[model samples]
Target: MAPSLDISDWWVKETQKGTPVIVTTKNHNYSVVEINSPNTAFQQVDKDRGKKAKRLDLFACEEEKILNDVEPILLSTKRTLHNSSYNDGDRLLDEDQSWVLNNVFQHHPNKATKMGEKIDYVTVGKHDKYQGTRCFFVISTNSFRADFSYLKCLKNYVKEKYPDGVKAFNQKYFQKRRLKGMNQQQTGMNQQQTQ
Candidate 1:
């Protein structure tokens, strides 16, 4: 049996506040929050034996998964939900309890004759040093617009999804600096008037 990790030890303590820690699944890597549960087992394995299993609480961010698979391809981040105990059934190919997923090709359709040969959309995300934010950007091959416009769309998407988080960041960090500048200007004006 593989050693079970305590819930508290799952996260890196030193870097927890610095940046989001990424956990890699077999299909793709993503940001996840580890949630602990008392009744970890959701389903039963053996009907006759009445054996219960512990399930890990891995809440993955869907947006992060989308950002990683930017090319018009399908992505699967779902793995079997089991903790510590490794069973052959937990392997992704177990057809009895598992189903095959076609990922990207099933979702998007291209009418062109050489549709399979060309990519319609490209996925992209990066941390902007000037803006100090990270988000996903998609560029469409069919569209005549430039890539920068796509980035603007991506920024808006992130802001819409995380309005409160973005607002807090602006108020705490960016807006605070601007406020400081305004205060300095006022102080300078007062000193000039006094002189």
Candidate 2:
């Protein structure tokens, strides 16, 4: 039987606020931070082990927190790339990663408007790892405002494209938004919301 899903509140909390984060995989004990910078590349720690050892460092302006938290799962599957095993094939990729990435991209804020343009976005790449478990690093562009706006647009775009997208989007957005709003309200942003 397949394993059950483990969804953590930590990942949702960080992503809703658009905060970049550092994710350390428990299985691999590998740590990486998602930042807003282009031109960053994933380093190859070893090349003898095949694709599972390779890591991709990518950049985008959106979903830094969500993406970082879900790295281990996004690339999970049963597919092979060269004659070697990867998260997608050998169960290296965590299932959680797939869930978060799929949900986030599908229902992100304002996703509809930025469907086809060169908007601020997030990009993922892959590399090789040795010694420990496979690892992937995420990067984002330097402009936070642009990235957030683009993500928002993308979310809306998806909603427009798919009839059921908005329903899910609304459910996810409101839950996180309410929590974040409460946190902000305590931090003295309550007055801003009323105005």
Candidate 3:
């Protein structure tokens, strides 16, 4: 028999070249979005391997801006890469309702797994969950604000994030101005909803 390939094995190696996904275990009736930050990447790494690995998108997309007198490339490591407010960081990504829940899931929360999540607004990538455990995917735009980290940072994001082409993505996924943009279905809704 042919060797079975892990779904994630087919996913792109870097989030920059694809849709840039952030995967987490499926939300429970009482999921805790931790806000007490480690204040540093190392500290964060020590807190939770999965969360830290998931944070690759945060640093790549959220912090991909020039802020606090530091380059977006994260050369200085002097910026407020993490927000103390859980609502601002993870909450913003998960709770905002802007992302699309997908089936393409990625595991290895202990490692930085970067890759484009196909051309969908959001979904669980790689798997229905991680390593036999139930999981979900937060599929947000690879189009991050290019103000934080510029040089050496997100160099591959623009060219590859949208594997299917930006214009097509925008037309297919973007909502109308009437919706004021984004969503807020607190139940961890799955599937992409373009309005």
Return the top candidate by TM-score. Answer: 2
Off by over 4 Å in 2: 1-154, 185-195
| Candidate 1, poorest ten consecutive residues by summed lDDT | 50-59
User: Model 1: runs farther than 4 Å from truth?
Assistant: 1-164
Cα lDDT tens digits, model 2, 48-154, are 64543332222121323333433343334112122164332232244533432354444555444333343333322222222112222222243332122223433
RMSD per prediction, one decimal?
21.6, 24.1, 23.4
List, residue by residue over 1-195, the lDDT tens digit for candidate 3: 998544343343442265534556533212234323223212333445463344333332323221212223233221222323322223234432231111012211211223243323322222322122112233335632111111112222322444334333233222231132223221223332332
State TM-scores per candidate. 0.19, 0.22, 0.15
Q: Per-model C-alpha lDDT, please?
A: 0.33, 0.36, 0.28
Which window of 10 residues has the lowest lDDT sum in candidate 3? 99-108
lDDT of 1 by residue, 87-120 (tens): 4223233331222112322222222321334434
Error of 2 at 167 (Å): 3.5
Model 3's alpha-carbon lDDT is: 0.28
Report the CA-based lDDT of candidate 2 relative to the real structure: 0.36
